[model samples]
Target: MGRTNGGGGGSSPSSDSSRKFMEFAERNARLAGRLADLKVGSAELFLQTTEQTRMALCISDPNKPDCPIVYCNQAFVELTGYQRDDIVGQNCRFLQGRGTKPEAVSKLRQAVETEEYTVVDILNYRKDGTAFWNAVHVGPIYHEDGSIAYFFGSQWDITELLAARETIVENERIATELRHRTDNLFAVLAAIVRLSAKDTDDAAELSEKIERRIEALAGAHRMSLTGEGLAEDKSNLRTLVESVLRPYRNSHADRLEIEGGAFDLSRKNITPLGLTLHELATNALKYGALSTVDGKVRVDWKETEQFVEIHWIENLGSASERLDTHPPTQGSGSGSRLINGVVRGTGGSISTDYRPDGLQATIRLPIKNKVSF
Candidate 1:
């Protein structure tokens, strides 16, 4: 005060501060009013905007229908085949039939009592006796004082989804059991191969090998009982490719190498694949590169999102003969029609490229298997 001076700049700064505070207060008041309006009318807003949405919805009084259903949308009515008049004011128990589980009801009760949100899969009936899987979600509504109000719920018909899950579980169970049985079978087969390998004599060795192979044929048969491919198989795509060439493996005395990832396939196709491989092996041993020494075979199978391609390549053999070199006699046996029949029967395509390098069979089968890993 002793140094007091009247300054226009100081007075102007104070006025500007006052103006800014007043403006901020006005904006905050407007925002507060809008938030209050939305908080009070959110339920009505949701009903007006999203009532016709595909997701089934219902509004009910949690405190009180017998367990009252206050509102149900068109989707709910259509899914359950109930008219508004038929469902409104009534307990949802009308939708419960023989399929309803008491445990789910207990959970629902617990949720309502605790004012907690609950999501559950429940069995419900339609207007017809047809039962369907219903996914129900129940949550508590709160009043201004944060006291429990009624309940809000949503129901979705998951009958198809539940059915699909069941099917998958069944398939997985079969796959697991099949894998165990197949593992035992392969153990026996590997032991036999080792036993057959014991004899060093060429002719006897070959004969024992062939005998062991004949025993391996039982693998497919065993798989047929339970329906699965080899347990040794680890890749679904490779299993598919191997199915095409498995019969051919060890069919030739010459080295045949299977190169690729592990795949899993069903027993449905395992038999055919085993049989096909057998046919190819028989042909190779009798007339193909395996008939001679210095001959080797390499099998490489690759899978992509769009296609699965298997390739069979045989190398130059000591008994090398041109692929065009026909047999002395053109006699027709199962040999003449085997590969063509199998491929054509499945409506798949086969292309054979016979070169001086050996026989290269490229099989392109469209990807139709829907596999879940």
Candidate 2:
């Protein structure tokens, strides 16, 4: 009975140890299974997030030749209009086309070589050959050992944004041009008012003279805008001169003559040239040759490869005596200043000679290269 009791006690301790060991083993196994399930769940969640995200996402394996695409999300496929089977193992550079800028491509290439994060605005083409502006971001995915494992890229379509920005820039440029034109018109009107006041003391006469000058200016402006009395996209020298002199011609058709070959003028030069001709004609009607019936005025022009030269000659006839009595002034008068300002502003030259027999004027303007306005 003593031996049986000792053996039973020893067996009891052994049984207790085996039971405890079995309990520990079971707890460890359960923990390992839970850990495995958590890992799988995390991977599935990551894939779901990437696939459902609005921004296109792609991954390329660095270990592969050419760093070809190994994984791409649904959004990426939709953005590029490519199926997974078609794009897999293909280099992302397949998206580039002829319209893609070299500078942008260079930047992306440099970033990839260095495994650095970079963002670029690139022109990319879809599988169907449609183009879109893409704002692309690329960065390296590193392993725990600090080695590059893959390159991850994200893309967003930015075509509309770029177009909007361009539209805003064009609007600003047009506004600036309109403002400049308005200021120039106001200045010219103010100068006319000041200059016209010097010639007449009678308020009615001054008002009439000012009105006539403004009308002439308006006529020139209309021709410039409508391209009337001019060529399709240019101004004809003879046509413009005759149009400006038409009002004076009605009364003295026999007294005025114009002689010029066909010559084209830039649109920018039309306004200034018209203003100068109008001023000259007005001065002749009031104080120069055209004040008398017998007086005659001749206008002519010649064009060269580099310049267009114009000549104005007045035969004073019986009015020749007035030059001795009145003695034509130099460029001291307001009328002369007006003529000078408009002519010189266009990189042209003008000169006037008050001879004993008549008044003579010459103008030379540079010929600029043709351009679309």
Candidate 3:
């Protein structure tokens, strides 16, 4: 809605506020001549109409040395907390102070230099030095000779609007994070159940195995979520491998061996890789070397120019025969596909070799230069 004002031009008092505007064509003969070239009409009641407008308006002379303000309406004076005498002949940049953005200033400069229109949201200070967000629109008015005559500027205080928008964006981000965490929780649980079911036929045994796997997965998930791998205490390759094999090393200290240089893994990849390692260890405990008292498994990894190669060799130097070899079962194939899918999804590959000595597996994944966690 717009404000009403008494006027001398018409008896109706221009009640149609939407039609009220600054009549640039009738102010000066030079301006009137310029507006004629643009096919714009004259406004006899310019001051009366523009005085009631809420929007701030100013006109500057581009032909001047510094593009100083020549005319400013009542709204512009009220908005800046400045009187007509203090602001006239001064550059509009006097409103800019400490917190103004340099990039936004650069954009405004480019627009004005090229005599093109531009809109920018910038921080400006009132005469009292109080800060406010101003959405400013500026454009050039051309003379009949195709030369730039004056630069017109309009402004609106949008501090509250911007604050509201930021609040909504933050709320949406929090909601999205909550949804992702809940989904990950369910996914990790389902994976544990699927992999544990393959290792046992008895219900009790499956339950016990799932409980242990869940404990390991929970620890890894907790660490991954703590600071998204950016903090100083972020989990790395060493911690990830240890978390997966912690449950398997209860009584046999010498059964598992890990050798790898530490590096950061994104939170997104931690769970998938952790589950893959858990699956491999579970398979060894069921039918491979881990089934025997003297069995041993050595896990080693090294980084290359473009990839990281990880090797899992069971009973590497032992004389134990490959036990309970029933050509790849349905359960084993499912586990293989799950592990393969995880590796492939991360732009990697996995291969399993069943030799007489033991099961040798190799996983190769590309080394991403940077990871977002």
| Whole-model Cα lDDT of every candidate shown, in order | 0.59, 0.75, 0.70
Give me the candidate number with maximum lDDT. 2
lDDT of 3 by residue, 1-373 (tens): 0002211121121222112212322345676577688664556346655678889998887666677888888999999999999888888888999999988787777777655678999999999999999999987665533455677889999999999998898778767656865686686577657865776799997787677667656766676766543233235777788878887877557889988888766455666677678878887787776777688888888888877777888883464665555223123554675676656766777888877778888877666723211
Question: Which residues of candidate 3, in runs, are more than 4 Å off?
Answer: 1-23, 26-61, 66-107, 113-116, 122-134, 140-167, 170-200, 229-235, 248-257, 284-309, 320-338, 341-348, 355-358, 364-373
Which whole-number lDDT from 0 to 100 does residue 57 have in model 2? 90
- Residue-level lDDT of model 1, residues 1-373, one tens digit each, is 0001211111111344345445546765796688687775757766765566988887666545244787888888888998999988876667888878989877876665555668988899988878888999987554433444456788988889988998898789878867855664565455435544443458775675547455545744554454333333323545544454555553642377778776454443444345445545555666666766667777776765654566767675665667565321113333334444444434454567667667777755445533211
| Runs with alpha carbons beyond 4 Å of true place in candidate 1 | 1-46, 166-183, 196-213, 216-220, 223-373
Model 2 backbone overlap count: 0
Ranking by lDDT: 2, 3, 1
Worst 10 residues of 2 by lDDT: 1-10
Best of the two (2, 3) by lDDT:
2
- Of the two candidates 1 and 2, the one with more favorable lDDT, higher being better, is 2
- Give a tens-digit lDDT track for model 2, residues 176-260: 6457545656766787799878867999988987887788777776666565432243677788899999988999899999998
Q: How accurate is candidate 2 locally (lDDT)?
A: 0.75
Q: Estimate each model's TM-score.
A: 0.45, 0.64, 0.58
Model 3 local distance difference test score: 0.70
